[model samples]
Target: MIFEKFGKKRESAPPHQATPTDDSVSISRRNFLKKTGLFISGAVVGEHESEKFLKKIFKVPSAEVSPKEAVKIMPHKEKHVSAHSPEALSEPSPEVSTETSKESSPLDAYSFLDGQIHPVAIPTGELAGNTFSDLYAMYLGMPNGTVVPETLHVDFKENLATLWRKKFNLPARSHDERVEREQLQFLEEHHNLMNLAEYVYRSYDAKSPNTMTLEEYRNDVVGAVEKSRKVFVDTLPLVPTSASEDGVFSKDKISLISKMGESLTADTLMSLSFTELMPLDKGSANAQVFGFLLRNAGVDFIDRIPSVYDMLESFGPYQITPDALSPKSAGSWATQVLSALPLGFMPWNVDELLRGKENIAAYTLAMLNIAQFIGTRNSAQLKCLSEVMHTLPSTQRAKAVLSFVAAAHHRPHEAYDAFDAFIWSMYVERAHSFREEDILRHIPTKDLREYTGKALANYRFLASGASVNNST
Candidate 1:
C-alpha cells in the first residue's frame, strides 16, 4: 500500500527474448555504454570548438601582426628622389666628364644643373622597423594603434564570452545568453507558487524575532489560506484537467498546498504550546486569542467546546476520576481511538485532550460516547459539522472529524451542542440551506432534545409530532 502511494510498481519487466544469460546482460551493458560514450564525447567536442571559435573572432592574435608585415603594409609613397633635375644629370648621373655634351644643345640652352626631387613626404630606409612602434605609440600612445591593455585574463568561460562580446560591440543575443534567459524564464514560471509558499512558511517560521509578531504570523497564515483558496477557485475556469491553460496554479500547487498546511499546523501547534506555558488564570488572554481565531475562521466546534463541558456535567459527575490506568497505556489507547475516527471530529478531540492533563484514554472514551449520543439527538448539527470537515485543509480536515469521536463520549450535553453546531455550520456554509428532513434522517426521535424543553427547542415542532405519533 505504501509503495502504491509512491506510484511504485512491484512487477518486473517480462523476460527479454531468450538468450544466453551472460550474452543478454552483456548486450544491454554494451548498448548503454555506447550511448553514454557518444553523448560525453559530443559534449567535449562542442565545448572545444566553442572556445576556439570565440578566440578567433575576438582577434586577440590580430594585434600581434609581424613587424615585416606592418612595414609592407605601411601606407606611404615610394621615393621619386632627384627626379626634378636637368635631364642629363637625372638621366644617369651622366658620367660624361660632367656634362660634356651637356646635351650641349639643350644644356647650353638650359645650363643643366643637378637638382633634388621631393614629392610629398615618404620614408626612404628602415623607418619600417619603427613604423609599428611609432604607430603603436601614436594610437596606443602611438599613431594608428589602439589604447588597449596588453592582456586580459578570464577564469570562467562566461566571463570570457561576456568580455569578448563587449569588445566586439556585439548585441546581447548570443546563444549562451539566450539560453540562460530562457532557463531563467522557465524556472520563474515553474516554481513561482512553490517558491512563494516556501518563502511564506519560512518567513513565518523563522527563529529570528525580527521576522514577525504574533499578529503578523496569524495574518500570514490567513493570507496563505486565502491565496490557496483563490487558486482553487480560479481552477474552476480551466477545463477540469487543464491547469496549464487556466493559469489557476503552477504544476507545483500540490507541493505548495502541502507545505502551506505543514507550516500552518506547526505554527498553530506552537501557539497551543504557548498557551500551555501560560500561568493557569493567565490563560484568559490565550482564550481570547483562540476566540478571535474561531470567530475569524468558519468552523463551529471552536464555539461549542465550553458548551460541551457544561452539558457533560448536566447528566452526571463528568470529572476526570483517574482510575487504574498507566499514562503510556492511556496515551496508546487514545492514539488508537483517535486514529480510527473520521476526519470531521478529530481536531475537536485533540483540542479537548490537550486542553487538560487528565487520564487521556478515560476522558477520550467518555467524550466519544457523549458525542455519539448527542450526534444522534442533533443530527442536523452532525451533518453541518461533516460539511465543515470536508472543506478544511486536508490534514486538519480529516483529523478534525476524528477528534469528535472522543468528544462525543466524554461530554454528552456539551458534546451534543458543540457537535450539532458544527454540523449546522457545515451545512449552511457548504450547502447554502439546511432542510429539517435531513436533520431527522440522522437524529432518532428517541433522543430528540426538544422533549427536554428549551434545551432542544430548535426541533420542537418535530418533537411534538413525533410524540403524538408514538401515542397514537
Candidate 2:
C-alpha cells in the first residue's frame, strides 16, 4: 500500500527540470564543490579550483583543476556524536528544546568494524568462502562490545530443556530427568555470561548523553522480556486433551517467527546496534535463538535486518573477511546485502518519509543504485544520476559510496563500469523528473541550472575518487 502511494506520486508529480537561459551556463566542477558543501582538502586544488575548471570548460575565467587535484583534498573534519539508546530519542527532558521535541535521536557515530580503513583498500582474497564461525572470534573481540556470555551461550540443547522445564513445571522422574536438570542449570550459568557480553558491547553508550539511565534501561529490558514471553506463549504448541502432553518447545519455526515479529517493536530493535542485538551466531543470542520465531512475518520485518547494518556502521566499516584479500570483493558484500534490502526499511530516509530533504545523499544513493542496475549507462542516464547526487551534501558521499560498493560486488564489472554511468543517468532523470512547470509557477527561481550546475560540480569534488576500487 505504501509502495502504491509512492508509485502514484511518482506518476502524478511534475517532473523536475531546469530551463536553458540566454546567459552563459556555469557548469564547472570546482565552483559546484564549494557551493554544495562537498569541498574537501583544497590543499591539493586551490580553493578556486572549481572556478578554474569552469573557466576551462566554457572558456570563461574559471580555473581548471584535474580530478587528481581534487582527490588530494583531505576530507573535512567531523565532530563525533556518541552512542545513544533508542528510548533516549523520546525521553522528555529539560535539556531538549521545545522546538526539537519531535525529533528522534540522531544516528550514532561509532563504527562497527573499527578504524577508518577504506573498503577499496582491503584485500578480500582468502576470506570468500569462510563460514561465519571462522570470522566469529574476530567479531567477538571487537571493542565496541561484541562478546556476551548470556547472548553467546553455546549449549543450546541444555538451555532449551531448562527453559522448557521451567515454563512447563515438569517434575523430576528419572536419571534422564536428573541429567536434563543438570544440563539446564549449566546452560543457565552460560546464558548469564552471554548477557554480560552484550552488556559489555553496549557499554560504549555510557559515554553519550543519550545513553539510557540504569532505571530506563531496566524498564526497557523488562518490556522486551515481556514481549518475548508473549511471543513464546503464542508459539507454544496447543495442549492436547491431557495437560501432561507438555512436549518440548517444538512447533513450526515460522509460527515462532511470526510471534516474534508481532512482539518486536521498532524501539526495541532500534535500541541496540543490529549486530549486537541480532548476533545470530552467539550461543544465547536472543535474535539468533528467537529470531526464527519471526521469519514468517515476511519482508516487512526485514527492517530488523538493518539493526545489524546499523551496528556495523556504528562500528565504522569492516574492511575484510578473515581470508578475503580483494577490497572489491569485501566492498561488494555490503552492496549485495543493501541492494537486496527494501528502501522503506533503510535508516537514511526517516526525514524523507515525512516529505523532507527530497535530495538527501543517502536517498540518492539508493535511487542511483536502482537506476544503474535497471537502466543502461549513458550521458542522459548519468545526467539524471548526477542531478540527484549533486544535490546531496558532501558529508554523505562516503555513505553513498559504501552502499553502491555493496550492491556492485555481485557484478563487479558492472559496478566498476557503471560508476560514472549511473551518475550521468541521474542527471538525465533529474532533468526529466523535474517539475519545471510547478517550479515556475510556485517558485521564484528563474533558472534551476545556475544553482544545480554549481551544486553538481561541488558534489563531484566531494565524491570524486576517495578510491572506490582500492583503499586510497
Highest TM-score model number? 2
Which number leads on lDDT? 2
lDDT over C-alpha atoms for residue 148 of model 1: 29
Tell me the spans in candidate 2 whose CA falls farther than 4 Å from its real position: 1-135, 138-366, 369-472
| Candidate 1: stretches off by over 4 Å | 1-319, 322-363, 370-383, 394-411, 431-472
| lDDT, residue 372, model 2 | 28
lDDT of 1 by residue, 171-250 (tens): 33323645434433422332221121111111111111122233443444345444433333233223121111222323
lDDT of 2 by residue, 1-472 (tens): 0000000112232221111122233333223223322222323222233333222222323233332222122111243322123332222212112121123111111112111211112222222233433123223221232333323322221222222222223332233636445433432333221121122122222222232222232244346444433433342233111112223223432232233233223222222222222233222222221222122211111211111211011111111111111111222322333333444432232212212111122222223223223233344543444445556443343333332333232222223343454445445454333321221232122333232222223223223432122211
Q: Candidate 2: what lDDT?
A: 0.26
Which stretch of 10 consecutive residues in model 1 shows the poorest summed lDDT?
1-10
How far out, in Å, is residue 465 in model 2? 35
List TM-scores for all candidates, in order. Answer: 0.18, 0.19
